[model samples]
Target: MEDSPRSQELLSLEAIYPDAELDITSYSGTITISIHSADPVGISFAAVPNTQPLYDSINYLPPLKFFFQLPETYPDTPPTVALLSLWLPEATLTALHASLLLIWDDFRDMVVFLMVDHLQEQAFVLFGLDPPIALTEVQFEFFVSYNREQLQEEFDTQSFTCEICQQYKKGKSCLRIELCRHIFCKACLLEYFSTCITAGDIEKVHCPDYECTKRVAEERKRMADPKTFITSGTSTRDMILRVVFTPPLSLDFLSFLPPEIVTRFQTLFTRDQYEFFKSNFPNRAVNCPVEACGHGIIRDDVNDDLVVCPKCRYAFCIHCTNSWHGKSMCRLAVRLDIPEDVLEQYLSYPELSKDRRDLEDYYGKFKLRRAADAWHMDVLFKEMMANELMTACPSCGVVSAKMDGCNKMTCHLCKTPFCYLCGEFLDRARPYDHFNDPVSECYRRLFEGMLGTEEELMRPIAPGFAL
Candidate 1:
C-alpha cells in the first residue's frame, strides 16, 4: 500500500529528527520514545497523512516537535505519532497513555484537532478580542474579517452576560457559564455560587437568567467528567489526534486496507505497560516488594508512590522501586546495605530519570531512615570523611596521631621534629621540650586547657558527665 499523502509531509519533518539518536527504545514489543530536551521534544509518525497535497497542508505551525515511526509494511498498518515535550500534567499524561489502547482502526487526528481548536479559542478569549465565531484553527487574519464584526454584534445582544453583575461576557479564565443561547464567564458563575444571592445560595452554578438553567446544567454535567473528552468509541479520540497529529486523517476511511486491520492495529502499539519484577539475586521472589502483593502495577499506576500491596500495609519504594524498608525495625547500619544499587541503576536509566524525579517531588514525605545501625555507620563515615583530616603532610601523615589526640607532637621523620601543638618546624637548638622542662610554657598551657587545672582535674566527675 502506498504511504498516505499526509504521511509524506510528516515524513519530511521526521527526516530532520530521526529515531536512532533520540534514545528511543522498544520494550515489551512496543516502541517508546523519551523526550528529555529543554527545547520542544518530539515524536515521529511512521506514516504521514496522505490526504490533501503536502503543499496545501503546510500551513499549520505546531509548537511541539512531531515525528512518525513507519514500520516496513504500509497501509496494512497505521503509524504511531509521538508527541514530544507537550506540557501535559501527569494524570492527564497517564490518561492519554491509557486512551491509546482504543484506537482500533482510525488515527486519532480528529480528537487532536478538536483539543487544539479549543485551546485556540481559549487563546482568543485571553487576547481581548471578540470571540471567534467557529472553534477551528484558522489563521489570525481570518478572525479579522467581516463575520467577526457580525458575530460580535450578535453576541453583545445575547443574554450571555452575568445577570447579577450585569457584565456582558462569554467566558473568563476560571469559569465558563452558559445561559439560553449564550455562554457566561466561569469566574462570575463560581462567585455567584459560593456567595449569597437574592435567590438562596446557588447550590450548583446556574445561569443568572432562569431561562438557561437546564441547558447549563446538562453541559456542566458533561464537563464534570473528564472521561467525556476521550473514551473507547467516542469522537474525542479523533479530535485529540487532530491536535497531536498535524493534518488529521482517518485511516479507516482509506480506499485500501487489511481485513483484520482493527485487531492488528490495536495490539501493535499499546499505551499501557504491565509490570513484573525479574530476579537478579538468587531465590529472591522477584515481585513487587509490597508484602502479600501479587498484583503488579499497570502503566498508569507507575506515576504514583502509593503502590499499596493489595493485601497488606506494604508500600513499595516508589523512588528505589524496591520493597518498603522504612517500616522494618532493622538499624540504619543493617538496612544501609539493602542493595540500593539496583534502584539506583533503574533510576539512572535515561528514560526513568524525569519520571523518577517527578515521583520524588510528589512523594517527598516518605523517605525512610529507620535503621539505628545504619545511623551509627553514617555518623562514623561522616566523621572519617571530615574535610580537615582528609589529607595530611607526607612526612608526619602516618606517624602523627593528630587524628585522635592533641596536635602537639614530634614527627619521627628525618629526626627533624616539629611542634605538633604550635605547628612550628624545629631543630636541635630549639628542640621540642617535654612536660618535665620548666621552659615548656606552651605544653603547660595545652595540658591545662585540655585537662583543666590540677585542682579541678584531680576531682572526678559523674560517669555521664559531658565535657
Candidate 2:
C-alpha cells in the first residue's frame, strides 16, 4: 500500500532527466524501469564502407535504450540491471553492466543519478565516437515518426515570431525548412511560394536569412584579431580561428518549402535546362519576349524584324522585348503585377529585397525565359521521332533512319542496342533472339517481311540481311 524507496527514486528521475524518456511498471512486488536515451548513434567500420546519405537521414539508428529491474531492496541490495540495443558489442555491454555495479557500491544509498551519468559519459566510447555529433537525417526520420504527436504538442507550447508575417504563431502552425532553419507561419510561406511559382519565377527561392548574411561582414570585422607569433627560434603560426556561429537557418534546407512549391520548381528547372542550351547553341536561336513562354525563333534574313513567340502566341519587335511597334522605336516598359498584400509583406524584408520594389521575381523571369526556350527546342527534336519517320533510340534519343533492314538496330552514338519496331532497349548479347524467341512479342517475325515473301526463314541467318 505504501510506496517503496526504489519507486520514489524512479519518480525523482523524471525531474533529473527532463529530455530523457522513461517507462515504469510494477508487477507483483518487483518494479521494472525502462530508460530511452535522448541521443542516437551510427558506427562506421574499416572493411564495410559507410554508404552515401548517412548524413541528414531521417532514418537512422534508434535511441540507445535499456531496462533495469530494481529489487525490493535496490541501492541497499545491489539490484540487477540489463542492457538492450544489439548495436553495442556484447563484451562492451558486459563490462558496462559490471562497472555500473561498482559505481552503485560507492554510494550505496543514492546511485541512479551517478549510474545514468556514467552511462552518458561512456556512450561515445561504446559507440566509437569521441564527442557525439547530433544525429543527422539517417536516424531522425524514425524518431520523428515515432514521436510526431508528442513533438507537435511540445512545439505547439512554444511560440515563434514568424519572419514573414511578423506575427507570433504556435509551433504546430509554424514551420522550419529542411536545410535552412528559417522559421515562418505555414500561411505566409505557402501563399508566398504559390504566387512566385504561378508567375514562373523560381530563382527567387531563398531561406530569407538576409539579416544573418549582412551580419557576417560585421562579425568578420569584430573577429579580426592582431596576427601574433611566439617563436622559440623562428616558428610559423596557423590562422587564429574564432567561433563562427552558423545561422539558425541554413540555405541548404529546402525541406521547409511547401511540397507543391518544390514539385513546381523541379518541373521549371528541367524546362530551363533545355532552354539555356538551345539559345547558347551555335544556331543562335532568338528568344521570345515573354518570360514564361521563351520560344525560340529562326530569322531568315537581316530584314526579319517581325518575330513571334510560337509557344506564348505573342508577336514582338526583334530588337526590343516589347509589342511589335512597326519599326518606330518601341517605348513602353515592362510592368510587374503583384498583389498588394504580398507587396506589403516584402516591404519589411529590405534585406531580401533591395531596390527591386516592383517585382520579387526579376531573378526568376530571366531563368524562366531560358528554361522555356530549352524545353521548346527539346520538344521540337522529340516531335520528329513521334511522327514515326525516324526511330529515336530509347537510351540515347538519337534519331535513326531505317533505310531497309529487320527490326533489330543499334545506336551509333551511345552504342545501345534496341528494337527498331517496338522502340524498346535490347540486350546486346542476345539481340536477335527478341524476334525469333517463342516468348517474345516479336516472335517468328524475323525476316518475315525483309525478303518481301511473308516468310520467316527459320533459326540461322536470313540470306541477305546482317545480324
Candidate 3:
C-alpha cells in the first residue's frame, strides 16, 4: 500500500526501525497504531521490548495515556510507544535493551506478530513499565485487570447525573480534573455550574474549591460536554433568567450566556416589555407640561441633555415623565405593555410557525430537542422584535419590515436591499451580500471606528464594490 501521512511521518523520524511496517488509525480523537517487525536492532524493538516482566509492567498502567508508534518500514527501524504522564525507571530501560541483544536473532522479524492484536492494550502493556521484575501468573493477571479498570475509571469521569439540571446520580459521582489530582463529587460541580448559568456568570464559574489551580481547565471540560446538566426537579430556567434581567446587565457580561438562554429570555419578556419600553422610551421624550408643546418630551436627540422633541419641541425631564427641565430625579421607568392589536400587527401566526420551525431545526441539529418547545419559541420571537425597534435603513431612510417567505428586500426610495434587523443595504447579486452589504459597512464605520484606530472605515467597502 502507498504510504499514508502517518506512514510518512514515521519514515521521516530517524529513530524508527529500518524496513518496519507501519499502520495508523484513530480512536476518540487520539491516533495510535500497530506495527510488526522482526529485527531487535530495529526502532520498534528498541522502543518496546517483549520480555515477560515488561508485559507485567505494561499491563499495570492506566489506559488513558497508552499509545503505540509504528514504523513505515520493517526490521531496519524500531517503533516508539508513548504513555502520557507516565515514567519508567532507567534500570528497567537498561535491562530491556540488554534483553533485546540476547533475543535479537529469534525475535528479529517475529516482533511484529506480537503486536497483531489489541494495539492500545499492547501499548499499555509495553510502554508503561517501571523497571519490570519477574511476576507470578496471578500477579500478571492482576496487572492486566488493573489496566482494564483504569480505562473504566476514565470513562466514568465523563458520565454524570441529570444533564439538564447538572445533577449527579448517587453512584455516578466522578469529577476529575486531569491537571490537578483533586477530585470532587459530580453532583457538587453540577450545582455550581447551574448557579453560574442562572446568574449569567458562566465566565466566573471556575472550580468551587479555592485551592484548585486547575479551575479554568476543569470549567472548559464541563462546558464541552453538552449532555452534562441537571434534568430533574424545577426547571432552573427561571432562576437563570432572574440572574440576567433583575440586575441591569451590561452588554459585555451578557454575551457569555449560551444562545439558548438568550433565546428563551427573549421569548418570555419581549411582547409586554417591548411595548411598554417603546411608549415610555421613545426617541421623543414622554409627555411634558411645557407651555409651547405640552404633549412632547424630547428623548435622546442630544447626548446627556433633556431637549425638545423635533415634532413638538417640548422640553421634559430625561429621567421621569415631568416638565422639570433643570431638576433631576424625574426619570420614569419606560412604560411597556403589549398592545391589543400587536399579536396581529407585528407577527402573524404564520410567522410564528416559521420561527417555531427554525427553533426546532436548530435544537434537533444540536441534540437539544427537549428545549424546542412552543413556549421557548414564543419567548424567542418576542425578544427579537423587542430588540429590533426603531431599526431603519440609513441610505434609503426606509423603515424595514420582516415578513415570512422573504429574506430579500428592496427599498422604494434608494432601491437599497438590507437586513430588516440592522437596516444595512445588502446587494443581492454578490455572494458576500449577506455580510458585506452597505448596512453592515455603515454600522461598522460608526461603532468600530470609535473603538479602533484612525485607519478603519465603517464597512471597509471598496470603491468598485456592489451597492
TM-score of each: 0.20, 0.40, 0.19
- The ten-residue window of minimal lDDT in model 1 covers 272-281
Candidate order by decreasing TM-score: 2, 1, 3
Tens-digit lDDT track of model 2 for 220-250: 4443321221113431112111122222233
lDDT of each residue in 158-262, candidate 3, tens digit only? 644443344554333554443343345655554555466566554444444455536554643543332322223643234222322232223223334456665
Ranking by lDDT: 2, 3, 1
User: Candidate 2: global Cα-lDDT?
Assistant: 0.55
- RMSD score of candidate 3 (Å): 29.5
Candidate 1 global TM-score: 0.20
Over 4 Å off, model 2: 14-61, 123-128, 131-158, 178-180, 208-263, 277-467
Give the higher-lDDT candidate: 2 or 3: 2
Off by over 4 Å in 1: 1-268, 271-326, 329-361, 368-384, 389-467
**Model 2, backbone clash pairs (residues 3+ apart or across chains), number:** 21
The per-model lDDT (C-alpha) reads: 0.36, 0.55, 0.41
